[model samples]
Target: MTRLRLLDATRHGALHLDRARGGARRRLVPLGRGEIAFAAADMPLCFAKDAQTGRFELVALLALAGENNLFTSPAGYHATYQPRAAGLGALRLDPAGADGLAVDEADASLGGAGDALFTDGSAARWQAELRAVVDDVVAGRALAEVYARRGLLRPLRITLTMVEGDGQVLDGLYVVADAALAELPDADIVAMHRADELAPAAILTASLAQVERLRQLHNARYPQQIATIGLAVAD
Candidate 1:
């Protein structure tokens, strides 16, 4: 793993990794007596390590408007952009970023704390869970076929929902899957929605199969909380 270093915005900065080196050798354009902006033109350009395969990687943190910030790869791939707000945690790359994750709404100093959770383990865990659910659905166990037809399994549409208290609410989540069975029953829909009961905190729904997988994973993670709610599978 490549640890990120905050280079001085004034002097030329470079990061040498095991396989690659990156740095900004740009001319410092003075924004103020205390702050200076490094123009990309003067910076030493570096390539981004493959996120999917490379064990070492580097990213640049850029300051944004209104105490907000953006994280991008050295190659300029936008990883995440966050802004400060009252009541709401920093706006995340995704909608559910605010729920399960604790965010500092009033404190700007706490910016990167919540960011680590999204970066370190939670993201990988969620992706693995999603893959497992997709595999299970494809094996013909749950209503995966129906969900694929209803635009409920599409990646763009799939979202994480946070449930407050003991209340239940019906909200639409987008997912990416093949279109096949659009005619789904109301009872089955209810079962799918109720699976969000796992933590009373948040749920990620991509399809009926995803819901089932979430329930099972949630149960395994929180056996005590799992006892409080009942999750039904549509037959």
Candidate 2:
């Protein structure tokens, strides 16, 4: 597995981020707290364990059952609000990466045709934004981890109701457990709120409401759209 590799100008100075028709097929997008306040409103946000690290991180579901990204068109993201990590192009956030940053050296868009990643032996102008995005992701993961250890997370399963009738079932996803949160003593909730962890946790469960929006988006984009997405939970 490719571990987190930091961005080094000398090693990857020739890289360029391509934001054209590429990456439209992205399904799960790394979503961080920096944009969570808005993203929670636009897309269905949840947590899924990373294949390499086996750690849960917040993600925006672009599509419920397909590889194609519903929020993104071939030209680019069609949503008015976009995840901060989406702006990084090939350089998505990785926990193993130093400072929560990593570069896809093999990204098809890195061959100097698009925006240059490095200029004059220093990071390019856009990297400042990338650093900010990664910072939020790193910080947000800290709070997300709290949910894992504190019994605030529960496995998520969703059934799709489409024009074709029984559609795909997506499982192995996680969401904040509101019932568990209600069970916690007042002190713990207050502590989490003081530490700025409680709200985003609430945001995760609240974001589930956007699954209907997902159906709407899919319906608007595809020839055969979906009617609804039935959600089920396993504690």
Candidate 3:
């Protein structure tokens, strides 16, 4: 059971977050634009819609090859790079709203010993770091909204086929397809560049290569249920 409560110094001053178990089993963690360049090198960045707003947002696949997280294991959580969302543990903060920070006391990570959450009637140092991550997420989404308005996004069609027969197609996800970027007029490209979006778009296009890496890792790790992944660009 989850016991979510507003973070009050009197209530949670002594509570700390356990880093190791914070984002342990999370399969899809949101990535901010600021983390893109770094994360692209470590994991595949994908786009999925927010369930509530139905607007596109960026997510990092904790496990690319399998439904289970590749970043975590029986031994322990071992991701090459940690997403900012992982640092939150059971904490939830609204980037758009003022003054409502809550934490799930139910989370194992939020327990007696870890890192102090509150110091002197206010959020501790870690909250500042996480708040910055939240701001980056908000800023990144603003840029993504611009990308959608400019028609830079296309369906990132992922085909899942069995070794012997037909399989399913996952097309709800979207991407900044390379071809779509190419189709943009030089003027538009220049404008995007001037707006500081050209680089991230390129990064998103380049990140698709990681999909095959995920498949290879998946095939190597789980031989019993192997998957063949494929991508297609829409015309």
Report every candidate's CA lDDT: 0.25, 0.74, 0.72
Candidate 2 deviant stretches above 4 angstroms: 1-22, 92-123
The C-alpha local distance difference test score for the whole of candidate 2 amounts to: 0.74
Write candidate 2's Cα lDDT for 47-114 as tens digits. 88888998888888878768777776645556767776765656754545433457866554456666
Clashing pairs in 3: none
Q: Which regions of candidate 3 are displaced past 4 Å? A: 1-3, 8-14, 64-68, 94-100, 112-114, 119-122, 162-168, 216-224
Sum up the clashes in candidate 1: 14
Residue 145 deviation, candidate 2, in Å?
0.7
Per-residue lDDT of candidate 3, residues 30-77 (tens digit): 888888888787667877788899788887766643456565554665
lDDT of 3: 0.72
Question: Model 2: clashing residue pairs?
Answer: none
Please list the residue runs of candidate 1 whose C-alpha ends up more than 4 Å from where it truly belongs after superposition: 1-167, 174-207, 227-235
- Model 2, C-alpha of 217: deviation from truth (Å): 1.8
User: For candidate 2, which ten residues in a row score worst on lDDT?
Assistant: 92-101
